[model samples]
Target: MDKRDWLILQMVYAEKNITKAAKRLYISQPTLTYRLQQIEKEFDIKLFYRGRRGVDFTEQGELLVKYAENMLKQQQDMEELLWNTGNEVRGTLRLSVSRTFAFYQLPQVLKAFNKRFPKVEFHVNTGVNIDVIQSIYKQDAHIGIVRGDHSWPSNKKTITEENITILSYNKIDLKDLPSMRRISYKTDPTLEMVIDNWWKENFSSPPISNMNVDNVEIAKRMVLNGLGYCIAPSIVLEKNDQLHKIFLCDTTGSPIVWKTRVLYREELLELAMVREFVHFIQDYH
Candidate 1:
């Protein structure tokens, strides 16, 4: 099928309604319906079950739509590569980063990159460090910036090291306090171990109960509202205007510092745009 047909299929699967998909694609409802019918007839199978409210993909339709989505993404990437192969760096650079890096690290880098390559557009996804790593491995993102130590398939380089600290709003002494509602960053294994060791060394128990938060922004909010206190990197906690540092925790060793890095698979490392971005980061330090 044509690109339009694939686009239509993708949008239909996403929206699940002929009329809504038409509206989103800027086409008429009849045109969308006719195109869908043509696809079903060509495949000799019904793709969707029409309902009074909207539509739903059948079992076979779901499988086809999944492939259609992947095909569309590859096509977009191909077109972008062809359009941007000249002197100027241009194309959509998909990135996934942790909120910790997004707020504390990426703004300046992004500004400098934009100044250098004005045509390069960024599509960023933010989550915990683990999600960022997975995104890069899956080829859903070209690059990832995240906290803690990570080992990907190939080409992992450290960008920066962040110092972490425990913070609280209350005036209670941190020495051997057992009843504490502690908020935790849902990131890497190393960070979790560091935090666990920090607790074992400082407090009598694991801060009463631990609460895991997906987003660092929300973790800061909970600390501000007195829901719980969290241990975060100074790079992130220093920027929080609402929360105040309760104690400067003493880690036995070099402290639980997060080492932020960029990872790439061998196949993607040789791409022109990828090399430019990687070098931009490497030389920035």
Candidate 2:
């Protein structure tokens, strides 16, 4: 019906429990229930089915939730767009970053950036490289921190580069790697092809992987426990990790390296906040 109603639907759908939603919205449970009943009656639909556990949205309710989400996003964008027109560097900065970089280095970077521009707010998301690229393409995020080798036709600057490494609790020879247990984790498809190509270059057969993990951190844990060795970018390797690092090389004896870059849409550079951030981040590394 209105902005408040839109928010009510979004929060109720997100939390699924009216009590939790009310708490988050800073309203009483009865008030939220009444609002929901009014909304349902006005639309002449059974929005949700209440149960002992929580609530399940009916088909119509799900559709309305999508509408509510879109409205809220548009509202946020309108406000940020207006802010961008001002001379002050104060607005939301939608930033998506690679998960590995988020874990290892992002906090310090954010802290320094905040010190430089205190008025700017951050709406940050972390995922793999492809997700970062997609956010920029879709304009869901103004900037993205992407990793691995990529061909971006627009504005991008390198933050850092590191070799793809074989990490182990103890030192081992490269010739023994194919026979030993190898830890594997899900990564971006581009990196997947790179690793697969590199593997085929060195060995005639597939690796003998004993463990598969959801992310690089879990695989690193397995390596630390001496379960198996893992191949990953050396960004995760730290001074205190105490793990043996073996950099992978090409057939020509050149080390295989991956880069992290800051990617942004060309037109987004017109925003003062975006321009300042793009420059600030490159100098961050």
- On lDDT, the candidate that comes out on top is 2
lDDT of 2 by residue, 1-285 (tens): 899999999999999999999999999999999999999999999999999999999999999999998998899878878888887888889999999899988888989999999999998999988788888887899999998777777889998989999999999999998899999998888777888999999889899986889999999999999999999999888778989989999999999988999998898888888999999988877
**lDDT scores of the candidates, listed in order:** 0.78, 0.91
Indicate the residue-level lDDT of 93 in model 2. 91
lDDT of 1: 0.78
Model number with the top TM-score: 2
Candidate 2 vs. true structure, TM-score: 0.83
Please give the lDDT score at residue 60 for candidate 2: 100
Candidate 2 has its poorest 10 consecutive residues by lDDT at 146-155
Question: Model 2 segments beyond 4 Å from truth?
Answer: 13-28, 40-71, 150-154
Q: What is the C-alpha lDDT profile of model 1 across 84-192, one tens digit per residue?
A: 5677677778889887778877888898988988888899999878889889877889888877776776888888876676666665566635666877656556777
| Residue 74 in candidate 2, Cα distance off native in Å | 4.2
List runs of model 1 lying over 4 Å from the truth: 14-31, 41-44, 51-67, 80-84, 169-173, 176-190, 208-214, 221-228, 238-252
